[model samples]
Target: MSKKKNKVRPLPQTVGINVPGVETHAHLDMEDFKEDLPEVMARAKECGIAKIGNVFLGPQAYETNRSLFDAYPEVFFLLGVHPNDADQYTDADTQAMRNAFKSDSRLKALGEIGLDFYWDRVPADVQEKVFRTQLELADELDVPVVIHSRDAHEKTLEVLEDYGWSGKPLLWHCFGSDVATAKRILDNGWYLSIPGPVTYKKNEEAQEAVKFIPAERMVFETDCPFLTPEPWRGKRNEPAYVAFTAAKVAELKGMDVNELWAICAKNAYDFFGL
Candidate 1:
């Protein structure tokens, strides 16, 4: 008789808490979960994650993972060229993004795009050009935009203002800016997607931002497999852990966790039309 082989499955590192909400930003298509993606999605659902916006960083990423929208009905996508990869963006890439947006109803927005001075991989001039190009694409398509600004908040807002972004829907994803910046974002009528950083004790700015931003204009995200919240910091993040961010923000706002979740979920739905 041939000996039988036993296969052992790995346990999910982060268990999701049962708190229904929407994770406004994540990258489920990334290679980080190549082996355990099914389990990750299941855990997110079990944790009451009703919907997720899976952002694609570039044309290649979008082309590779475009099937995820049909595979998971709860998962929508945001296609754009990230500022870090701005140098590599081409006319062909822009056309591909346009085609994808046109063909897929699940393509909710154009984003994870903006300025990132911290990396400095692409020249600031090139980043701005790519940023403006994508913004124009979003404007032409009449879709919302998700922005990623790091160490370039002033420039980011300047570009948005220059583009006459007053009437469009804009989301500042993973907002870690100061109170004044938050107020400015609010003044521009842009939504803010809070992330796991709010759960950290040292993230006073995030906490303060949450306090000032009204409930209607606020949303939550995981930005996983990154920015794992407190108690799971330094570990891989996933959609399920977005609850921690909600709980922390709720506490800061002196509201019940579920109430905050519902508000943010509705805000996400309204903003992304999910």
Candidate 2:
């Protein structure tokens, strides 16, 4: 027999604790996972994610989120109309969200909501209108807000300045801006969530932003099914891969992976009030 064919691999041995993790933002309701959600959640648990903050982005995402929470209890839900979905927000949609807020404390935050002037499929005016409406709803409901801003940082900050957060908890998810923009968010007492793109070779802007932000205010995410980190960049990402993002963050912040992991988990717990 050839040496390659005769190779004996050792049996997999029991490993000690992997880094306890949290995927701060993900779309578990996305169509990609529709058929295999149980397997996906099982993988996440096996990889040591203590919680997943699922983004409710579709007409059905809220119901999907509710069902996940009911079924898994460990999964957390945050509701929002996505920027691309600005055209879909009607009085009925907003009311559905409000009713969910009234009915479930499992609904922890209002978001993945903000301006996306990048595509402008919806007019800037429409995006602003929907964003302001959601922010108002968040303030009225007294829940934190998770913001998704892309190529509209000034507009986003301007809207926040104009309407004023009025002491509501705020989070800027998938933060891809410069150090200045990161500083503005940090200065306003909002949290900044970094994602897998931080590990990309050409993502210097993201890396610079991560370097400047204070570790205490920083959080991590996969933004999965998108922004998959290196070595797995082209594959469909799941919460199980969040450690790669965290490892990248640790490299940037010059801390041990476990230290950063625990710090981020603590920040998430404090931010989401879990």
Candidate 3:
């Protein structure tokens, strides 16, 4: 047989311990995984990812792609209209999401929502309106809210504070901000999900924030097909790559990589009720 030409990369399992870990955010149903999704899942399993939270951009994606993970009960979901698509948010979509949450037990949190000021795709007013509407939906359903804040952290904080989300089941996703912002989120009694960007050498702010953030309040995510951590930084990110993030986080906190992996996994389980 002719030798395959694929380059041999380091296995994430080499960096990760055999203990069960959780990937808090991923978009497995996206086109990036379309060609090798099964291989992706197997790699994730080999690296000790016992569970994964697949974030669907909107209710339509959820309804259309929910079946992708039917055989993999280890994969749960996070559904919401992203701030970038605020203009498309409508009542029918809200109702569909409500119905899915009620009927589908795998649906965990209403999230990856909030604001994205870095992108000027949607008008600010419309984004705010859709965000509040989804917030109301999560509150009414008594489910947790997962936030996606970019350069709009201040305004996002103001909205959440005014809505009385302090001490509520809120998670600040992709937390790449400074220590002060992290402290603010912690003060509100919310959990923070650090993403792969934390591994970059230039991200001193994220490093500092992750260093002191209490173990109990900290969790991890890959946000695959987006932010890939170092050692595999320029490649297409998959769930298994979260091990690199765990290693970086553990290094920053002066803890063992395997131990930190398990701790963050447990925190993810608790926060998402997995």
Please list all clashing residue pairs in model 3, or write none if there are none: none
lDDT of 1 by residue, 108-165 (tens): 9999899999988999999999999999999889999999999999999999998999
What is the lDDT of every predicted structure here? Answer: 0.87, 0.83, 0.91
lDDT of 3 by residue, 165-220 (tens): 99989999999998999999999999999899998999999999998799888888
Indicate the worst ten consecutive residues by lDDT in candidate 1. Answer: 8-17
Sort every candidate by lDDT, greatest first.
3, 1, 2
Top candidate by lDDT = 3
User: What is the TM-score of candidate 3?
Assistant: 0.96
RMSD (Å) of each candidate, 1 decimal: 5.7, 4.1, 3.0
Model 2 vs. true fold: TM? 0.91
Instruction: Give the total clashing residue pairs for model 1.
Output: 0
Q: Candidate order by TM-score, highest to lowest? A: 3, 1, 2
In order of appearance, the predictions have TM-scores of 0.92, 0.91, 0.96
Cα-lDDT of candidate 3: 0.91
What is residue 191's positional error in candidate 1, in angstroms? 0.1
Instruction: After superposing candidate 1 on the true structure, give the runs of residues whose Cα lies further than 4 Å from its correct spot.
Output: 1-19
